[model samples]
Target: MALRKLPTHFFPSLQHQLRPFSSLNLPTLEPSNDAELVSKMLLHHHNPFHAMESSLQLHGITLTPHLLHQTLLRLKHSTKIALALFNYSKSLPSPPLTSTSFHILIDLLAKVRQFDLAWQLIVEMDQLSLSPTPTTFFILIRRLISAGLTRQAIRAFDDIQGYTQTKTNSDDFCFLLDTLCKYGYVKVATEVFNKKRDGLLPDAKMFTVLIYGWCKIGRIDMGERFLNDMIGRGIEPNVVTYNVLLNGICRRASLHPEGRFERTIRNAEKVFDEMRERGIEPDVTSFSIVLHVYSRAHKPELSLDKLRLMKEKGICPSVATYTSVVKCLCSCGSIEDAEELLSEMVRNGVTPCAATYNCFFKEYRGRKDADSALKLYKKMKEEGLFVPSMHTYNILVGIFLKLNRFGIVKEIWDDMKESGVGPDLDSYTMLIHGLCEKQKWREACQFFVEMIEKGFLPQKITFETLYKGLIQSDMLRTWRRLKKKLDEESITFGSEFQNYHLKPYRR
Candidate 1:
């Protein structure tokens, strides 16, 4: 069975090798004439597996599954022989799979994400009375889940449950649970876990999975109670369990840090310290939560130290950690520190998200310096960094109005339109107010008319700012015109509008 290294032109030897097959007493599969034989030899043996095998040996070649299947089928061989050929080809040391093998071929194809072909092979396996292994079903289910085919995955899981009488292992349960969590099928996962309660222990990992699912969907109390139940049942919480619980606590703290039940910050610290005492090394996620607890308590300096501690423990600072630092610095109006940290973030290949830009913009707003804020906005756009959120635009417009920087205000209004940053009603109102404040009555009136044309009827403050601006310009006729417009629009103008803007002018 030595494979001779034939010459570059190997057909003569192959023709001689296949010639004996023609005289064999095996079912004769002749291709009509010598021309057909020559054609088959050139196609299958000379050109490889597409050619018929009968003439292949004459060209110093061998039969492959692809070649054998076609030759056997042409000779009207039994289906059993086809199956045998397929199985034999599976064991070959070259070219991999046989065309006729169903199950093995499907398994191989499934491993490579060729699920459509694998499904066809499964149908073939069913025809042959071959059962798919749990691994096969699991692999297919995982693929379905990743493809976001949840309903299909559920059907597949149901199929797996029906076909097998053996108890599902922890790994299988975890896979189902994770898939359920991904698709927000927590109730289904819960029912599955509960139905198999006697056979399954609610281990720490399982509890963590369930808790995280509940927490993700804003069921913090339920998640916390579940965590306590695990603790009460003497189930030791693992790192993931504690990390998720700490996250829950931080979320509560953020929502209501100064509320009546405001001890979440202390509770988070306690959990972190307890986790450390239990020999569970706090990872960067856990450390970031602890930093949040400090930040919530208005102790940014301590949060910074925790950042240093994270580095000391070989934990890399996550984007969340960097964001928290920038937020804290901006809250304290430490713009320089915030800017330096942003530079550091860029150096470390961390691009600031919109929230980071917002934090800086908010500080600039507090500084009441429209020029600095406008420059930062231009810089953000020029760098092709994060796009400003609606809140960013709102803050910018508000600051520009406060500083009476009407030119920059006009630029913002035009920029928003050109950049497809559609502003809400508040943005329009703010622009109108900015115009009125700068005594740009004609422009303000035009903007107001545009707002009405766009179906945004003027609010009470809009008329108020316009009326006040007109009075300040000592244009009695224009004030009457605005009042008439307000009356026609049925917008209730408050006394503060008239008193604040009209009193001095009336005097």
Candidate 2:
């Protein structure tokens, strides 16, 4: 099949003339059928502007609102096509302009980051006595907020108010506040919230969002102030509201330095107590936050106590809850307890995730208990609980390499492939490092070449292992060949390894 050649404007061409729609050879469009045809052309063509021109040639001066809307929908991601269509529609004797068509074009322009054109369309709509819909305002507001144009978003909101003469709902206000908070504009969000709250009765969810915003910025005091203000305004806080504040307080406390760790944990505990006393029932998330505080404070026993209390309260522990307790138990050198909890989690019909297994793997690896780690790996496979991830293989590889069991390493590597887990950069690095450590220069070289072929550039540690292994194995000639290939590929090995000379292996 032969490929169709596009026109010169599709690519950069100095000699190509830019012409109006009237000068182009366009088709006369049937308002009903040709809109669908134009839509198809825009979808399949390389230059949608050219597609629009062709459609115009087929349906001269018959551009319909439906056709323009369809074309705009197809070209929403292209600013050039949108502007071309806009200009082409303007050239018609009686342009088929409607609110729906203008909305589509404005949305298309906004999506392509041509905000000025979209705003101009809104102004034009106003002049024509056409009020923009809520959807049109939403699209503009979201785009402006996403682009970090808070001031422009505020202006648009005000404009929307003037156009509709109706009060904005809680969802709209919440969206604007959330966007401002997400982009670290909490102060601006507060001002916007205050401005809107005067006219609209602020709800619990709205207050919760503002509290979360303050908490996100580590302003716990400010968050608390809002909480109190909400109560003063006779709004009852929900479980979600309490959980948000609890999580924020616990997170801030966890980040305190060692000297302040105890003090911070105590503060988090006080908040937890207060939450329960306020008649707000603690959920799994609330318990998880408190459990995390206990873990960070090096109080695994306390975490276990809380776990008991959680069950007593009939709050079923989630996978995250089990994982947290398991992690704390492992950190405190209580592997048996952690393993017992893992079984308990399964018995309760809650499947352990990758993170749960990783906690056991890391603990076993740290203790140099490869046998236990392997048993867990086999158990993971035998139980069909979850497929072993790259981290699982990496831990096994590191352990086998440390024990100098190259044969087992090879077996695990084969198992990794048979299990359908594609090796990432870390996997390749580990295998190459393992092969080099065993002085298997030829095998290491093969893996190195394969790694490069897979498009992963070796890091400094990879090169260091290869350099040391090759020099010690008296494979100087092979090293020179590898260096030459690296140089040709423009791959750097850093200055430290670059200056090192090959010395004769001392027997």
Candidate 3:
């Protein structure tokens, strides 16, 4: 399908809204602002160009490279919309896009299954003597490494070794190390980093990516060690570096919460304070994370306190900052307070994403507040700003099932399909879990079968729970059907459901 050319009115509107970069001081404009504008523009549905034009003018916003980058970073997972903005911007008359834009977009094409288009973009870049730095080997390494093809990623890395720089000191080396680290190949990424580090000049961003890799895999100690090593080299760990470490501590605590949950929260707070001590004031990300830390520890007071401190310090709270506080409020069952904070977020000009509202759905589920959840869902549709996502429907269905509102579960399920939201892994997991809890073994088995039929490998735990439920079920026909399907899938109540994974195909 051809995307319509930019409407005639778009250019003057965008150009007028965005004063020439020089006049407005491009240096200070954060990409997140532009990215958010683009994100909201996506709500238009018909033409993203029109959506973007109207959104920018409606908000009287300007687009600068920095703001665009931040918004794209936030919308990285919203690839379709991001690419739409990317394409839409290519047709614009002001604030010309850069090769860096192409670099990240090229880096992301595989994620959106745009292999041929990715190549075509590369070819176009090559024609302009601006390849955005992707060799075929780069894409191969990313895809192969992502598939746990470490040997192949390495082999492909070797294929592009004809460049002038020595293998260890090249940008290719950094790319290889970074990609390796990104996919939980941290052990291997560490090996690659160490081998390259013997005489290689240190780069903080390179180290930051590795630190994030380790932290991503729940190895906070290794992340800390890297931080220490970076600091010892007379290199200052930037705010981003600290945020990575903060996330590491938060992840470690989340995974190993002893019900007390205090230890991790303390460690996270220590990191937050350490940032201040080092003259690296915690940014919005830092506050948001600590907010999450406080929330998880069930310290709603601490969460609220940090939120106020965020405002007092003049650190503008990002959507994440507000959402984390909202989540905490909802989790702590301060539903009224949560609603107020959400309102505050909007009044403060922070647009709520689908995730922010999902927090409320989760709370409604906890309290079996179906009417409230349904009311919110209706409002989300009517408001047209933040569309309910797959997570939304899954939460709604889960809420109904938990409340013993089975009829509404069917309604939500149909609505989900109608809206083209789910039946994804979480959807299956929630359904299976909900059905098992309700002892609705027959419907549970039905979804279990359909889940596998759709090529979603069932989580072993869910399979076990369902299989056990089926065995205990009085519905003999459904049990036999599920048993036959399980046989085909190599899943038994005892075995790891059909075995081999697959969090990133399950990473």
Candidate 4:
């Protein structure tokens, strides 16, 4: 859809208010005095153009570039008024507008979506031989890209090359390329890079950003091509460049079958080894990515080997590093080893995050070690290193429910509320199912109502469980009321519950 053009009448009233300035014999007030008087007038007048004209006539001052720039700054909040003020200043006989003033007005116009007027001003600047600064072009290009006008932004960038005085540097090219790539316009970004590459040499960080952008969109081949191109250009790849390629390879590996996955990992490891050979020492991020790859490939032993090597190299394992290894250990049923690693992490002053604790929680639950799971939960709260996520509460609720510990289940529910963790679908499901199983109909009904009010639609199993308990407890009135509410919500009990007959009750 086309953007609606700004209304013409938006400025007519202000334009009429400034018309009387033509008749006044304005004097050449000092620039400082003119700025001071205009600033005062701006505070009282609703229309900035009106304030500027009134100040000029009263002080008998002409709008010099310095004075006009000051007035533009004062009126920067309203684009329409600023544009009117700029146009009106150009019509004055003394103290004409300068390139600096034009730059400010054009930027203001672009900001307010008045691109047509801004382009006109740029053309005017060119005709007057007023060369735009590099900063001016940079701001214009960035704003254009942000407004989803990539084509216009590219055109504006091309215009910059025509100016002999304004030299576009590496930073200027990188800024536009980065913005374009970030917004999923990689092809456009490539065009920009190609346009400026001969003049502005691409640095390592620039190559890294482009490679990362390609990797992000799952085009690993393009990323590799860029890496090779960088190498061919005699630009040595840095640690970040290799890491981006490694991450891309690992991510692609994850999507493939076992045979292809192994091949991908081998390719990634080659890059890793090559980086080390080149004396670009691996950082914590490099190690983390390798460990994650091994974890995904289901090679816990290899992950352990990497951890040992990481420690040997004096690179400390981060929370992510430990978490990756812990997850690998748990997945392969090496729960004891995982626990020892967790203990080692604590001994080394590294606090295990919520995810780290949750990893152990799942393993203990799977092994039917209820006591151990409860101990871990207590430790999580006691340490207060991290708040338990909703998943944490759901696990505890499920474990206590299976153990038939009703009081503990309620306590966990209260804890979830106190910690500001809103119960999700599974949380409500477990609570409702557990309460109904224990024949606590009143409490079950309260939670059921609360769940619906919070916009959670109970599954068919939830309806069946609640219906069975209500009928068994002979709460015919409560069952009928619940039925009416469900009917109002357009939800019907599944056919599986059709066999059960309910006693009729008066409304």
Candidate 5:
């Protein structure tokens, strides 16, 4: 919610400096929930402490029980503000807050490792005669897991029946699996599934999450085994299940692009084929994945065949689909063919992103054809195909810097800032590294200072390389000044780093 006046409801960290949103229509959000309404007033209009008193009076809308819950959930990500609002709400002369309300506040407290306070409130809910819902335990379990209290999360789940009146259902089982899998606790989630597998009959979703969890940790073989188990036990795998395995297979295959790649690719194809055999038609995501694998294999023909098959199947190829085929064509030196596909994609109304254009730029970059690369970049900007993202700028700057084109690098750097793409750590690193290579120690020092002030920690190698240049130029005063700044910022530069004066640049 970066939009103005309506509120930065999503990102509390980025809530400041509400930019003018002249292009936006405020009335369009007319039915925007009370959550956004109060959130806007609280965050944008008044101070956090006196917000409910002033802004709610000003807004003149009542905070109903449902609205309060929604607002709490909306601000759940911002624990401090949410806790303040909850505490404030408790003092209000409205209906007594429910067990569910206490659950959210407990969640906020638990996130900050204030588990003692959270449990006290949980006990207090019982005192208030509020019956605990399964969500009471779910909230505790989820937040406990997030806090890396894995055993505690499981304990909370086990204590669910003892606390909450509601019996755990399939939804609860799947929810726990989903939550655990989300945090890369696949093994633990599996253990819970096995222990609780007595009376409860599981579904495809239960198995899918386990597959997803296994896939997330790069265990493609384990994911494959789950798929086999599902099929053998008369549990049917859907498009989502197949898609997950295919993604895992493609990812593994991409990494092992040596002798193992072909075998891995064959496995992906088998899962893909199994989908069609089971009457599960591949969605755009499935097709795009297959296209990506073909791109990695550098099979331009196979990539085009897949693209052709997609159109034949009446499935629209996405920007990702075109980008994959472009990568394949570019890899095999079919620049003309890739360009033709890009045009085809545009004609089909799927706008090319930075990645789609980056493929062409990369081809020219590899050939050291700076003129052709810049030409394509210029054409894209002028034609309004897409704005070059920070990543695009980073790549363009690297290309210029590699060829020692400092003048062009400076121009691109200025343009990048002008485009409102603030230089991040990677951008600063690229510019500082490039400057060091050119013996522009002064510029490197300035940018390095800016980088540090912006809370970016430079790599030890980069720091040493830049400092070595300063020392060689007899700039000990400059070194002392920078060293003082580092001390104030509580950043350490050990004696070994300062002793870069003795050794030449390692490279």
Candidate 6:
């Protein structure tokens, strides 16, 4: 017998159908109830199933339950798809919600704000005997809280304990409590936390969340009480736990007394030493938090000395660590040291991003040296890294406009346009102001018309610039016509414009 080739259109259609099944949001296939069709589909299935699996993997879509159920129903009840799902799930960081995949569909529906359909999916999961896990309950709990359904979220949490063996973590319980607090349900969150804390082991992570929440709500003293209780209960404080406590103290100190702040800083150092003694490594964030608090509190010299201490303790500084030092130099008007520190950053292989240049530019704000600023700008572009943001263009524009280098200003605008940055109202306004300063009233007025045609209605200041330019050039007719238009449009001319144009005529 000769083999028959399948039609070209037939294979392509099958390939297209499988390419984005989930993205296209296909309907669920009732595979278990269909047998004859299943036999026909599975007759020559190995190659087709392999092809489908490979294509779906490349597209980053899993063979969802609907996809699986249909694929299995149309073919023999084999575990090929199951095995494929396992391999794909392993490649991800978070473990796949395999047992509760149907429940997850409900979670996804909820996330997309399709609450009614999501409830239907929850009911479906119950019917299928695929119980929801704590993670599953957490999802619905968070969504309900976000939607302002505090009562519903709590009720859902109460019912979820019956669904799975996976014990709800402290964070999960705290999240519910926090939601209760947010919706004038503070007593409820407090009550729940007290009960859950008594029943479950006090996790440091959960304590950090509660303490932060309390501090945020102007209850720092209450948060401190919780902190002391956690430490007294023999639960060792982690970096986050200490950091939260320190931050709360620092915030209170800022608003209240200098003595309290100084004592807090001294106590913070003691806590740092204790963290090291207990064999808990202080991460870069831990170091940065202390440095930031000290720096903001007018203690940069101490912050710098602490950086040295951090390095001595075998804790390497991060880019944020180095950037903080450069910013401090800039703030102190030590531009030379700030520039040198930028060099140090590059040498240390902490390549400067746009933010580094932003600080550098701010230090040179009044210099307005086109040659120097443009050279630095070109160096940044040549590095083939650190694409200048909109602020960068604005700063350069201001510099050249102040220098009355209109040609250079236009060139900057051209470059900005090519970079896919359309001139904002401010950019256009700046250019028009520059034109008016040079007494090129005709060009300034034409630019104003062009800006309006480009869908940007000029601000009062923009029109004020044009009106002043005309009057200064002794083009009285043009000035009166513009004033009439302003009156018709109800645009108020401020004293700033009168001081620029009307003052000379009064003298």
TM-score for each candidate, following the candidate numbering: 0.44, 0.50, 0.60, 0.47, 0.60, 0.46
Q: Per-residue lDDT for 356-416 in model 2, tens only?
A: 8888888888898888988887777787889777778878888888888777778888877
Task: Judging by lDDT against the true structure, name the best candidate.
Answer: 5
Candidate 3 per-residue lDDT, tens place, 255-316, comes to 34465476776787798788889998777777777777777667789888988888899999
How does candidate 2 score on lDDT? 0.68
State how far residue 225 of model 1 sits from its true place (Å). 2.4
Supply the global lDDT for candidate 3.
0.64
**For candidate 4, lDDT tens digit of each residue in 197-257?**
8877778867876786687667889999999999998999987778777777775455357
Residue pairs with backbone atoms closer than 3 Å in model 6 (clashes)? 38-74
lDDT of 3 at 244: 77
**Candidate 1: where is the Cα deviation over 4 Å?**
1-223, 229-248, 251-265, 273-283, 432-507
lDDT of 6 by residue, 21-108 (tens): 1121223334343333332343334332252453234234444444544443332122233323334444555534344454444444
- Which tens-of-lDDT digit does each residue in 302-388 have in candidate 1? 767888888888888766777777888888777898899889989988777777788888878877766687788888879888767
The candidate 1 region of ten consecutive residues with least summed lDDT is: 1-10
TM-score, candidate 6, is 0.46
Error of 2 at 72 (Å): 32
Per-residue lDDT of model 5, residues 325-380, tens digit only:
99889988999999899889989999888888888888888999899988887777
Error (Å) of candidate 2 at residue 307 is 0.9
Tell me the TM-score of model 3. 0.60
Q: Distance from true position, residue 163, model 2, in Å?
A: 29
- Backbone clash numbers for all candidates listed: 12, 11, 16, 1, 0, 1
Badly placed stretches (over 4 Å) of model 3 are 1-185, 196-202, 216-219, 250-279, 436-449, 459-507
